[model samples]
Target: MKRAAMVVNPIKIKDMRLLHREVEQVMRRHGWAAPVWHETTIEDPGFGQTQQAISDQVDLVVALGGDGTVRNVSTTLLGSGIPLAILPAGTGNLLARNLGLPIRNRKVALRAALAGRDRAIDTLFVEIDTTGDGVADESAICTVMTGCGLDAEIMASTSERLKARAGWLAYPIAGLRHINARRTPMRIALDDNDFEDERPLTTVLVGNCGRLTGGVRLMPDAEPDDGVLDVLELSAERASWAPLITQVLSASTRTTSQVRHRTAESIRIECEEPTRVEIDGEVHEHALAVRISIKPKSLVVRVPRSSKPS
Candidate 1:
């Protein structure tokens, strides 16, 4: 019998007892006897609880929350080769959707986690210079994407109160509020190639998998295990807003032409002023420089066998 550890986020959806019952039922059906369970807490996210899962030597660590919770657990389980199963309870659930896992309801997601096929995916190492000392002081993130610029600012400014009330729609409401204040001069270099642009970028995103909030396909060709990062650089020039708007509106179903894109094994970004950077939707303040790179096939993640071509 295989041991499984389920790390759940209590704040996400309602009916905890029902979810647990469904998860346990699935585990029993799969011959995973009495899988261990853990819940995320404010005091411990990355280290303490995950280490517990590791000490128990579980075959899998299930993340049952949003992207932030997934990131927290994934960071702890990195390199352990213990596959992660996501049960999306977050507002965006971007990573879950990218993998083609069912997210319409918790029952469906829980079933997929227990029965889905396992696939290896690439993880990114993000280093941020926090002290302006020209040295990276913090590192994190495993799936989806990370970036620093106008988009990071929007992420930093978004209010939790609004998110709890309106779900993912809160992002655009906050975006509308900050749209006029989003311009910045940014220098982006992809593997030593330099490109400088001054625009009110709504956000600049790097995706390992193609989906964004609200099922937006930011990078139509991104593959999580491809050993490369897909960079989507959006610029809001004086006359660029109309087209940019069009792109964003269409992003949920299709790609827009207003965004510039590139793929590289590594990237370096620098900004004139200090800014907030988001890795899988969590915000952090930093001096300017960010180094991102792929850790090709570093993590084992559960995915549907019939998932869309990555």
Candidate 2:
């Protein structure tokens, strides 16, 4: 890359000094100009900094955080024609995991980011009914996946203090505590499909890509560049989750009657009661409904040349 910028989450990195030194050395060795660096704040994770990178006309914008930072940076870079490079530094590096990027070694991650192929990926546009206006208007973009119901509980209940020390393990620990949490009744429709009547649902997930943290593939057929979103629904009783969890933990597509899967360019979901929601692992306020649509091949991402399609 001729010129680039980095948007970092300061709190996630263990040693900023070493990371900066190594990154700078790599850029210099590659004969690239020094990158403009931007740090994420509590108020602004990465949106504003990504905008600044775009305004400065950087060839690439590297996101050095977790899923939330990746989503924000992708939202800002949408339609900008600038490719994003992932240098994961936080727990639940979902996007990087799905993309098959090197997450364990900083050197490999940096090299793959700097000398990788560009892949166009789909993004989801979500309009949430946050105003109680009854109309879905307020919007946001989700780069990995958007979820409601049980998964939201897992994310919301996971203590930040625990997350800081235990990383992605914090989620499941909190989740085990809420195993018997009641399911919400929801009505849903996909693409041109008729709206299904409200029924108790343990979780509803709409994904641009299938993989979750630790190589778990929740939707085997979901493809980021496919121009359609993958929908997975769990409507089983609490007692039935054991086998379902087994399937998920094993990354197996085999599912029973309580599980449903569909593919759509758009989806509309409304719950009988307000329920918490999450986008790219970031919790949002409880909402009674949401409208999600796919924008195919909307963002360009950098991945290792050997990377398979996410």
Candidate 3:
């Protein structure tokens, strides 16, 4: 029987024992051996466990957490030729939603993953500079969206307690509290200065795939394996997100002074003041600037063989 590594976040799961038994039943029915499970910890989320999976030479790795868990697992699995499967267990299962994978159903996701058909997707390599000195204080690989400004603030301000109780609704609650926050003055350069702009922006989102938690298509044209990133720069001067959200929801490409969308292979963002940045759903150390580059076809992800990916 083939082996699999299950990297799970216990906090995201409701009942560990029952979940284990359920997973075992699926493995047995599918002719896969009982999986070697590795639980994610507060100190070490999914990196160490995913690395272990690679060392163990498992047939595939299943990530059973939220976007953060999937991001961490995929970062380590990138370029390893190991296929990754995600079971939506977080507040924003953006990747699974974007890929049309089974959402919030671990059994179905695991079974589909085990069945076959994996796709190669792109990943972002980000270097964040905290000191404004132009040196990267931290670097990591991320799949899905990463950005600064309002999005990061909302992610940071959201209470885990409320998130546990309300799920995606918690983000809207946090957003309402932060709706009046000030925008940051920044300069954005795309493709090594192929195009550049300066403005006070509320949020700058770069997505490998476009689709946020609330069914808002932040970047309507983003494709994970398209070998580029979609950039959305939003600005609102009057402490109002109404106009900005309206523009996004309507899918208008008529760039207003407040909303701009572009496609790039690499991007550099420098802000006048320190800013919080969110990669996937977790907020990272405040950064003065960030540099992001796309790695084409870097990660292989499990998907339904016959289903058309979103």
Candidate 4:
């Protein structure tokens, strides 16, 4: 029987005993050994637990939490060649939803873990220069999109209580109040290009994959394995944002000139003022600059056998 090390975020889980029984029964039916479990704590999310799982040499490592938890476990599992299975929990299950995983059915998700096919996807390596010393003060890994300015503001402002009550809808609800917020001036560089002054923009996002919660395709052309970063910049010369909001609500690839889209292997962004930046869903306050680059097809994840990703 194959072994698995399950890394779980206990805070996101509703019932411990019930989940244990359910997972154990599934393991038996699949002819696999009961998984060795590691729970995430406030201080250490899933990185340490995933490292321990890797050390255990388990056949698989399961991420059972939100996207942040998935990012942590996936980063640790990168280049380890051990496949990852995800059981989506909490508000924005961005990666799980993008991969067409069963978000609400834990049993089916676990079954997919046992029977699904494996596909390798890209992950982003973020270098943050919070103090603007031309040196990276912090580093992070992103399995989903990361952004600055208003986009980061929405993610940072979305409350846990609101998400628990509203699910994916909470994000849009939180975003409504900030639609008219002031834009920030920024200098952006893509790949080998020199930094250029761009219009004061509402937000700048660089994504590994292009799917937001509630069926919004914020970066519709983005592919998780495409080996390129999908970059989005939103600016409005006028104070009103109805057209931009409509574009996002439509979920269409076509966009107005206020919305600019590009693809690159690496992106460097420097803000004129301190801006909030987010890696996955966690916010970093007072980030002056961030450099994002793609680590192409570094994460192997279990996807539905019938699902095909280009």
Best by lDDT: 4
* Candidate 2: pairs in clash: none
TM-scores, one per candidate:
0.90, 0.95, 0.96, 0.96
State each candidate's clash count.
1, 0, 0, 0
lDDT values of the candidates? Answer: 0.77, 0.86, 0.88, 0.88
How would you encode candidate 3's per-residue C-alpha lDDT over 239-281 as one tens digit per residue?
4667877888887766987898999999999988889999888
Cα lDDT for residue 89, candidate 2: 77
What candidate 1 gets wrong by more than 4 Å, as runs, is: 193-202, 237-239, 248-258
Error of 3 at 128 (Å): 0.6
Q: List the candidate 3 regions with Cα displacement exceeding 4 Å.
A: 194-197, 308-310
Q: In angstroms, give how far residue 135 of model 1 lies from its true place.
A: 0.8
Clash pairs for candidate 3? none
- Candidate 2 C-alpha lDDT tens digits along 27-99: 8887778899999999998999999999999999999987888888999999999999999877888888888
Q: Give the Å shift of residue 22 in candidate 4.
A: 0.7
Cα-based lDDT at residue 125, candidate 2:
97
For 1-310, candidate 1 gives per-residue lDDT tens digits of 8878888888874888887788888788878877788888888754667779999999888888888998888788878878888888887787788888777766666666667788988888898886666689888875888867766777777787888899889888877766566555667778767765544454568879887667666777787888899888776755667777677556533445557777898887777777789898888886477888888888888776666632
Q: For model 2, what is the error of residue 180's alpha carbon versus the real structure, in angstroms, after optimal superposition?
A: 0.9
Give candidate 2's TM-score.
0.95
